[model samples]
Target: MSILLSVILPVFLVIGIGFLAAKRNAISPAGIDGIMRFSQGFAIPVLLFQAIANLDLREFDLRLVGTFYTGSFTCFLIGMLAAVYLFKREWEDAVAIGFIALFSNSLLLGLPITERAFGADATQANFAIIAVHSPFCYAVGITAMEIAKAHGHPPHTIPAKVLRAIFSNSLILGITAGLIVNLTGLPIPTVVDEGLSMLVRAALPSALFGLGGVIARYRIEGDLPTILFTLSLSLLLHPTLAWGLGTAMRLPDEAFRSVVVTAAMAPGANAYLFAAMYGRATRVAASCVLLGTALSILTAAAWLALLS
Candidate 1:
């Protein structure tokens, strides 16, 4: 418990300070753009590439994959529905809420913590699910948003627009490219490998710090209820759901424990960053992020203890 809390506390403190800073008109979103871009474009890809590359594809199980996907998909769908419905908003607004609500920060926060608590196997399980997550966010997640955004506009070509969004997404393209490299089993040149390694090294800390910078600029005054609601879904509801789903699926103990805790432990999905980037309810998303991140330390610690 102490070990888990020790890791989470500092991470969120930076996030909290970031939030307070944001509220105070320090480190505005524009100020953090470079940090955000570098982390998203360069660093996160390195982290994700190494993760997927290290995965033993032979160990990939369709049944296990099905079970994991079932859990993720269900949670995402349900959470989003709840959020949108609760907000008394339009379907597009609901779609945005659903996208963020359904997905946790499985990549940045979940992966590393799972690695620490459970080992590579647990981390990889989440990674496999997350590989699915990355694609889904690009395809299904964004399409929902784009469709919502376009509904009021004059009738236009839907398929072309959808394709454009998918093809143009750097994260989607990066993951697809990385997976292709991993699946092909080609030997990477040392120089290329080193180059990738350097980028990956920068990805983790830079992203963390960038997240800190974003938080530094967050405003949380009127959004407290939304913050609490999202936290309940993330730190509490999501874990409970994962626990129930893991049991029904008959997952192994480590896998079961890891996913249950990880689903709960992960910070708000960086998709919140997307919300702000596009200027969609940025304050709401930012506030949820700041609060969710701040509470994660205690909540995660409490969760670790309960699991033990």
Candidate 2:
């Protein structure tokens, strides 16, 4: 209950404020777009860069990464197979559905929730997971999408396509630069580091508010069954797998909490973007992003309580 009030509610309150503001026409759509662009494009990337650049490379745990990603991949496969075999979705649409399950809101939801539940200093595992998150999810999602569209075409072009898609992202660029600094021990000037620190402080709140406003644009109108199923994969199955695996591997409390909390996040807006990018299942993806986020408020609080 304390966790719900202190940790979860504040985060959602900000989101709710944004939702109301947008719904009431208090903030123009262009204003919401500007907020999202600043947060997603600039502030969040700076946050990631600072976190990754300063991370202790020695603390990078394979078990932690494996636990989180194994869960993600499992959910992806389950979502994809079920979308096709059970829901009678087309292959391309199935792939898009799978991606909605795979791409958790690790940045917008994971970081703040974990930081609030644990503490600011306890997010190294989260950073480690996030460092590779976009690349890994996009790779799997794009590869599957291409294969679905190929109809048995040779996959020789898939790697390049995946690289192009992932690298083109600003978040990926920030991560890449962070890795370079971490590995090479390059020094960031004190003034620039301070500037980035200022930006990092604005990242989560701004992004969360922007996310809520963006979600307000989506209507929960169709594909109810598929949306519910994908939500199950994302909010339930993914974290269950991580929890089981993390326990089996005896992950330390911090790492265990990080992986599970991150896994428990709702599908990100990127899910809808991926669906739109492929021109498949866009409505379903949009609905999932909106409804799944609403559901995750309770689901995430439950996970935090159990972890406690």
Top-scoring candidate (TM-score): 2
1-308 in candidate 1: lDDT tens per residue? 56655656555554556556556667677756786789788777666676677677776655455655555556557656766676665665565555555667776666666665556666667767666666665566666667777857754666676678666766666667667778898677899889888988777566766677776655676646555665576678778777777777788776666676667754454657557545665666767776777677677777767766
- Clashes counted in candidate 1 amount to 8
lDDT (Cα) of model 1: 0.66
Q: Distance from true position, residue 100, model 2, in Å?
A: 0.8
State the lDDT at 157 in candidate 2. 86
RMSD of each: 3.3, 1.0
Regions of candidate 1 where Cα sits further than 4 Å from its true position:
13-31, 63-69, 83-85, 120-122, 149-156, 266-269, 277-279
> How high is each candidate's TM-score?
0.83, 0.98
Q: How much lDDT does each candidate structure score?
A: 0.66, 0.93
What are the per-model numbers of colliding residue pairs?
8, 0
- The ten-residue window of minimal lDDT in model 1 covers 61-70
lDDT accuracy of residue 221 in candidate 2: 82
